[model samples]
Target: MGNLDGKVALVTGAGGMRGVGRATALKLAAQGADLAITDVRRDASDLPPAEVRQEWHSIDSVSDEVEALGRRCLPRYADLGISDEIQTLVRQVMEHYGRIDILINNARAVIGRDKVPVTDLEEEVWHHFLDINTTAVFLCTKFVGQEMVRQGSGGRIINIASNASKQASAMGAAYSASKFAVLGLTQASALDLAPHGITVNAVCPGPINTDRMSYWERSQADAAGVSLEEFRAQIVEQAGRATPLGRIAEAEDVANMVGFLVSDEANFITGQAYNVNGGLLFH
Candidate 1:
C-alpha cells in the first residue's frame, strides 16, 4: 500500500508541463493520494515571444495521469493570487474530496518585466510579485489550515519557495524579496499551526529546467545579443560547473523533495525551509 493511501491533496499551478507542481502532483498520486490540481489556464500576454501558451489541456493531462495511477483527480482553474478565487477553490476541493490532507502552494508569479534592476523597477511590479508569491501563500495556508484544523487530523502544507529566498539577486530584487517573505510565512505559520498538529514548510528549488526558466533564458539571451541556443548552452555549462553535483536540477528533482516532506517519514519535521538546489548554496 502507498504511504498516502486514502488521502486527498490540493496542488496549485500544476498545469505547466515541466513545472514542479505537475511533478509533485504525479508523485503524490503515485503514493495513493487523490489530487485537486489547479492552474491559471490562460496564456499571459507578458510571456516572451517564443513562449507559447500552455495548451488548455495542461491540467486535464495531469488529471488523466493521476487517474491512470488509480487515484481520483479534480482539475480546476483559479488564479490563486485573488482572495475570492482562493476561497472558491478551497470550497470546491472540499466539496469534491470531502477533506484536504495536503496543500502544495506551488502557484507563483514571475513576470519578465520584473527582472530589471532595482533602479528601473516599477511599484506595480513589486506589488505584483508579492501578491502572488507571498500573499497567496498566506491566504492558501490560512484557509486550508482552517479546514485541516476542523478535521482535527494533522495535515501537511508545503510552500514552493526558491533558492533566491536565501540570497539577493543582482537584478532580481522583487522576486528575491517576495521569496524571502515566503520563508518567513512558512516559519511563522509552522509555529501557529503546531498546536493543531499541522506542519508548515517551504521547498526552495534551484534553477530547474522548466518553461519559465526557458523564457527567462530567452530574455537574458536577447539582452546579451546572443542566440537562444548559445545562451542556453552557456547557462547550462555555467550552472553545471558552479553546482557541486555538476548539474542543474530537473522538475522531478524538486518533486522528489516535496514527496519526502509530505510523507509519514517527515511527520516530525516542520517549520523548515529545505533547499533542493544540488548543493549550490550551503545553509
Candidate 2:
C-alpha cells in the first residue's frame, strides 16, 4: 500500500515539465493520491503578459502522467491572482474527489528576466510578483483550509519556498521578499491551523535543475554578452563551490522532501522551514 493511499491532493504551478511543481505532483500521485493540478498558463497571455493562446494540453499532459500512475487526475487552468478563480478551483476539486487531504502551493511568478534590484524595480513588476507569489499562497491556503475543516479530517499544507527566503540574492529583491513572506505565512498558518488538526510547513530549495534555472542563466548571459553554454557552466560551478553537495539540486530532490512531508512519518512536524538545498545554507 502507498503512504498516501486514498488521499486527494492539489498541486499548483504544475504545467512546467522541468518545474518543482510538476515533480511534486507526480510524486504525490505515485504515492497513491488523486491529483488536481493547476497552472497559470492555461489562458492566453498567462505569462510574459503578451498575446498568446490558452493551451489546455499543457496541463492535460501533466494529468495524463498522473493518471498513468494509477490515480485520478484533474488538471485546470488557474489564475491565483483572482480570488474568485481560487475559490472555483477548490470547488472543482471537491466536486470531483469530494475531499482534499494534501495541498501543495507551488505556483509563483517566475519571470526570470524581469528581476531587478530594489532601486531599479518597477512598481508594476513588484505588485505583479507579489500578487501571484505571496498573495496567492494566502488565498489558496485560506480557501483550502476551510475545505479541510469542513471535511473534519486533518490535512497537510506545504508551501514551496526558495533559498531567497533566508538569504539575499542579486537582482532578486522582489522574489526574495515574496518568498520570505511565504515563510511567514507558513509559520503563522501552522499556528492557527494546529488547533484544527491541520499542518502547515514550507520547503526551501536552492538552485535546482529546471527550465526556470536555465532561463535565469540565459538572462544573465545576455546581459554579460556571453554564450548560454558558458553561462550554464559557470552557474553549475558556482553552485557546486558554494554548496557542500557539490552540485545544484535536481527536481526530484525537492519532490522527495514533499513526499516525506505529506506522509504519516511527518505527522509531528509543522510550521518549520525545511531546506532541500543540499546544505547550501545552514540554519
Candidate 3:
C-alpha cells in the first residue's frame, strides 16, 4: 500500500502536459491520493505546439490520467488571481473529495513583460507576477490551511518555488521578486501552521526541462543572437560542466521532492526551502 492511500491532494496549474504540477499530481496519485487538479482556462491558440500535437488538453487530460490510476480526480478551471475564485476552488475540492490533505501551489506565470529588466518593467506586469505566483499561493495556503486545522489530522503544503528565489539572474527582476516572496511566505506560514500539525515548505527547482524552459531558452537565444536550437545545446552542455549533477532537472525530479515532503517521513521537516537545482545554488 502507498503512504497516501486515503489522502486527497489538491494541485493547481496542473494542465501542462510536461509540467511539475502534472507530475506532482501523478506522483501523489501513485501513492494512493485522490486528486483535485486545476488550471486556468486557456485558448487553444496559446498552447505549445508540441503539447498541442500530442493532444494535450489541460486539466481534462490530467483528470483522465488520474482516473486511469484508479483514483478519483476533480478537475477545475479557475482564475487563481482572484481570491473569490480561489475560495470557490477550495470549496469545490472539499465538496468533491471530502478532504484535502495535500495542497501543491504549482501554478505560475513565467511568460510576460515581467521578463524584462527592472527598469523596463511595467506595474501591471509586476502585479501579474505577484498575483499569480505569490498571492495565489498565499490564498491557497490560507484556505487549505484553515481546512487542515479544522480536520485536526495535519496536512502538507508544498509551494513550487524556483532557484530564482535564491539566486537572481539578469532581466528577471519581477520573476525573482515574486518567487522570493513565496520563499518568505513559506517560512512564515510554516511557523503559523506548525502548531496545528500542518507543514508548509517550498520546493525550488532550477533549469528544469519543461515548456517554461523553452520560453527561457528562446529569450536567451534572442539575447545571444543564436538559434534556439544552438542555445539549447549550449545550455545543456554548459549545465553538464557547471552544475554538480551534470544536467538540468526533469519535472519528475521536482515531483519526487514533493512526494517526500507530503509523506510521513517529512513530519519533522518544515519552514524549509529545498533546492532541486542540480546544485546550482550551493549557498
Candidate 4:
C-alpha cells in the first residue's frame, strides 16, 4: 500500500553500510519499490571497521534488508567506471524486472590521491576520477533514461552530487570539477527528459557521517600530525558551529531527501539541485 508499490528503483554504489546509497535503497524499498542495487565487488577486510565487525556483506546484506521490508531486490556487481559494465547492468535489470521506474545515480569516484592541490595532482588520477564520477553518471543516465522514455510513464533519477558542486574544494579539484559537471548534466538532462515525464534532480550534500568522510578526515589528521580521535572531534565541532543546524548529518538525512524527491510529493520539482547540507550553504 505504499506510494511506489509496483515501482522498480536502481541504486548504484549501495554496498557501503553507512553510505547514502544503502540508506536511499532502504528508503525507496520501504516506500514499496523493488530495488536493483549494484556496487563493485568488495572484500570484507577492506571495509570499514564497523562494517567488518558487523559482518556486512555489502550489496548482499543490503538486498537482505530490502527483502525483509517486503520488497524485491536484485543485487549485482558492476564497476561503475566501466561503460560496458553499466550497459550490461541496465540490460540485466531489464531482463530481470522488465522495467525500471526510478534510478538513483549514487556511485562516484572515491576520494583519494586526487585530494591534493591541482598542481600536485596526477593527470592519470584526474582522468580516473572523471571517468568514475562524470562519465559513469553520463552512461547510467543515458541508458536508464532511454528505458524510462520507452516506458512512457515517466520516472525519477536522483544524482548524489556534493556541496562541492557549487563551491570548489580546497584540495579536491578533480572531485569538485566532477560534481560541477554533474549539476550541469542534471539540469540539461532534466530539460531533455521533462517532455518524457521523467524528473531528474541532484542532491548536493555537505560533510556527512560516513566512511568516505572518515577517510578524508583521517587524511587531514595525518597531514597535521594529530591523533585521529582529536582531529575528528575538532572537525566535527568546527563543522557543527559553521552550520546553521548546529550539527553534522547522518546518511539517512540525505536519504530522506532522496525519498521525498522520488515520491509524488516532488513531482513538480525538476532541473534543480537541492543542497541537503544542514543549512551550511544557502543559494
Candidate 5:
C-alpha cells in the first residue's frame, strides 16, 4: 500500500512527453492516488513545424501510463485559460472521483516568439503570459479550493513556479513577472487554507530537461543567431558550470519534490516556495 492509496489528484498540463506534469502524475499514481489529468489538445496550427511538434498524444498517453501503474486515470482536454472551462473541468473531476485531495497546477503558456526586452514587449504578449500562467492558477485554486473546503478533509495544492520567480531575466520580464505572481498566490492561499488542514506551496525549478525547455532553447538560439546544436551545447555547459550541484535538473527531480509535499510527511510545511534548482538561487 502507498501513502496516497485512497486519495484523488487532479493535475494540469500533464500531456507533454517530458514535462513536470507527466512526471508528477506518475509519481502521485505510484503513491496510489487516482489521477485526473488535463491538457490542451494541440493541433497543427497550435504547434510549430512538423519537426518541432512533439509526436505524442498528451492526455491519452499519460493516462495509459498512470493506469499501467494500477491507478485510475481520467484524461480530459481543457484550455484552462477560460474561467468557464476551468469550472467545468473541476466539476467533472469531483463528479468522477467523489473528492479531490491533491491539485498540481503545472500548466504554463509559452510563445515561441523571440525573447525581447521589456520596452519592446508587446502588450498582448504580456497579457497572454499573465492570463495563462498567473490567472489560471488563481481560478483553479479558487474553484478547487472551494471544493476541498467543502469536503472538509484538507488537501495539498502545489503550484509549479520557476527560478524566474526569484530572479529577473534580461529579456524575460513578462515570464518572470508571471511566475513571481504565482509565488504570491501560493503563499496567500497557503495562509488562507492552513487552518483547515490544507497546505499550499510552490516549487521553483531551474532549467529542467523538458520539451518545453527545448522549445525555448530553439527560440533563444534563433534570436542569438546560433544553431540549435550550438545553443544546446552552450546551455548544458553553462548550467553545469554555474550550478553548485554541477548539473541541471531532470523532470523527475521536480516531481520528487511535489510527491513529498503532497505526502503526510510534509504536513508541517506550507506557504513556502521550495527551490529545486540545484542551488542556483538561495532564498
Candidate 6:
C-alpha cells in the first residue's frame, strides 16, 4: 500500500490545468490519497475580476484522474477569497469524506497587470490579496484542525508559499506581503498545533512554469515594450542568472516537497518553510 493509503486530502486551488495546485493534487492521488479539490470558478465573487485563460479544464481532469487512480475525488468550485464560502466548503468535505487528513493551502491571488508599489497599492488590492492567500489558510486550518482533532488523528497542513515572500521586487507588493504573512502563520500554527499532533509547514516555490507564469510573461512583455518571445527569453535569462541552480523551478519539484511533508515520513517536520526555489535565496 502507498504511504497515503486510506488518507483523505483537501487541496485548494486545484482548478488550474498547469499549476502547482493541480500538480499537488495529482501527486497526492498517485500516493493513494482520496482527494477533495476546490477551485475558484468564474462567478460573482469577492475575488479579483478576471480568470486566466486555460487550455485544459483542470477541475474535471484532476477529478477523473484521481478516480482512475482508484481513489475518490470530490471536486468543488469555491472562491478561496470568501470566508463564508470556505467554511461551507470544509463542512461539505467533512460530511462527504468523513475526515480530512491533509490540507494543501494552494490558492493564490495575483494582480496580473497594473503593477503597483506597496506605497501606492490600493487598500482594496491589499485586502483582496490577503483574503485569498493568508486569510484562507487560517480559515481552512481552523475548520480542518477541528475535524482532525475530533478524529483523534493528527493532520498535516502544507501551505504553498512563494519566494517572493522574502525577496523584494517591483509589481509584486501585495503578493509578497501576503506570502510573508503565510510563512509566519505557518510557523505559529505549527507551534500551536503541535500539542494536537498536527504539523504545519510551508513550501516556498520560485518561478515555476505554471499558468500564473504565462500570465506574468504576457504582462511583462507589454510592460517592457517587447514582443512576447523576447520578454520570455529575458525573464528566463534573468531567473537563470539569479538562481544558483541556473534555472527556475518546475511544478513537480514543488509537488515533491509537499508530498514528502504531508507523508508519515515527515512526521517530525513541522512549523518549517522549505524553499523549493533551486537555491534562489539561501539566506
**TM-score, cand. 6 vs. native:** 0.89
Clashes of each: 0, 0, 0, 0, 0, 0
1-283: candidate 3 lDDT, tens digit per residue? 2399999999999999888999999999999999999999876645665576788889999999999999999999999999999999999999887788999999997564566678888889889889999999999999999999999999999999999899888888889999999999999999999899999999998877766434656767889999665777777677767778888898999999999999998999999999998888865
Error of 6 at 281 (Å): 0.8
Error of 4 at 5 (Å): 0.7
Stretches off by above 4 angstroms in model 1 are: 44-56, 213-216, 222-230
Regarding TM-score, does 3 or 6 come out ahead?
A: 3
Instruction: Go through the candidates in order and give each one's C-alpha lDDT.
Output: 0.87, 0.85, 0.88, 0.89, 0.88, 0.82
Q: Rank the candidates by lDDT, best first.
A: 4, 3, 5, 1, 2, 6
Per-model TM-score on C-alpha atoms: 0.92, 0.90, 0.92, 0.93, 0.92, 0.89
Off by over 4 Å in 4: 43-46, 213-234
- Please write out the lDDT profile of model 5 over residues 119-145, one tens digit for every residue: 888888888889889999999999999
Error of 4 at 220 (Å): 4.5
Report clash pairs, candidate 1.
Answer: none
Question: Clashing residue pairs in candidate 4, if any?
Answer: none
Estimate candidate 1's RMSD in Å.
Answer: 2.4
Q: What's the distance in Å from true for residue 61, model 2?
A: 1.3
Residue-level lDDT tens digits of model 2 in 1-283: 2389899999998877667888999999888899999987643323321112233355687888898889899998988889999999999999999999999999888666446667888888788778888999999999999999988889999999988899978888888888999999999999999988899999999988665533455667889999665776687678778888788999899999999999998999999999989887886
TM-score of decoy 4: 0.93
Winning model by lDDT: 4
lDDT of 6 at 46: 25
Error of 3 at 153 (Å): 1.0
Q: Candidate 1 has what TM-score? A: 0.92
Count backbone overlaps in model 5: 0
Q: In candidate 4, what are the lDDT values of residues 136-162, reduced to their tens digit?
A: 999999999999999999999999999
